[model samples]
Target: MVISEADHARVTVAVMEAERHTAGEIVTAVAEKSDSYHDAALHWAVLAMLGVPAVLAWRPELAPRIWEGLVESWSPQPAGAPLLVALVGSVLVFLLFRLLFTWQPLRMAMTPGATKTRRVRRQALALFRVGAERRTRGRTGVLIYLSLAEHRAEIIADAAIHDKVPEDVWGEAMAALLGPVRDGRAGDGLVAAIAQVGAVLAEHFPRGENDVNELPDRLIEP
Candidate 1:
């Protein structure tokens, strides 16, 4: 495919921006670009290498005799040796490509920007469940949960709020539910917080019946 000069320049800028955010060296950015190119090269090389062997093995004049002799020479000990070898070799090539061309550079490229760091903290608060627990490290918090559908992790707070919570008693609860002012079990913590916050806002400035009735129209509008 033809890549326009403008597009190439844009990509180069993006790569540089990513490096700057992550605090990566100039050589690291260049190496990342080179590794991406190398990954494409290695992918094509492996396909060509395997295709050559496959084509030779499938030739009409030689294939039948070769198959017959191979079957006769095989023992009951292990039937998948060749297939296993090919699979293992393919895996090794892929791993090598990842090691040499992708991992380090991509990591450098992913160095968190300030905006990204802020977003992570917001997500932690958003996903906090009522009884969810938290563990802090440096500038981030680990929010843990045990729900069936949404069991995983989230990064919450930052160094700024690390000591803001009075004690560890409700840290998990706050981490799970975002605000200590809200109540209920961990699983329902977020819902409770939203309801409480909404209620507080509604009490101060209640919506009239006419405004509430207009909700259907607002929702249905294209």
Candidate 2:
């Protein structure tokens, strides 16, 4: 999302240069975030609701006033007063949490890292299939996907590249990307990653005579 025109051009040029020496197709994509994580937000809200009782238990002095506030009883209350107060407290807590989580920073913080990883990988795979898979004649397409909010990246290769290259072989490329990304240099990181990925592709799938570029060499922001 922070990428500018210069950054976009750099990525496109890197991809084109990488493809020149190899028959592999490379697609670069960036997303602000992979998911909204509504489920994580809901879970946080529910936990807040569940915590109300524990909180009230710690501050017993608050219970009587809270109960009186809910029913405004001038007379002795029935046995159900405690239940009413609890319900009211839980609802208030839940609502407060929901409101706070509407702020994206809080919501993202509450989401588990494992959940974000899964969503980011899932989204990258889906995008690669749509934007790169089988689009080239040799089926040597590769995708470099960056999710900014999660600070994560994924590399997806098509049939030919997958058959020739081991999954661990892409670790250097991933590292090249994340190093700069973590430093708030996403564009530079992406360019470095494309070069790394391209080098791997070139090594395994050298370009053939009259090789044609079957895919565009532009960055996709979807």
Question: Which candidate leads in lDDT?
Answer: 2
In the range 1-222, model 1's lDDT, one tens digit per residue, is: 122344335433433332232211111000101112343445544664575346545663444444445556554425544454445545666566456545544433343344334444344454442212232122222232122112222323233233543334334533544332123233244333223323322333343433311101000000
Model 2: per-residue Cα lDDT over 138-204, one tens digit each? 8999999999999999999999999989999999999999999999999999999999998999999
Candidate 2 error regions (>4 Å): 54-62, 69-73
lDDT of 1 at 62: 43
The stretch of ten residues in a row with the least summed lDDT in candidate 2 is 77-86
Q: Candidate 2 clashing pairs?
A: none
Q: Return model 1's CA RMSD, one decimal.
A: 19.4
Q: On a 0 to 1 TM-score scale, where does candidate 2 land against the true structure? A: 0.94
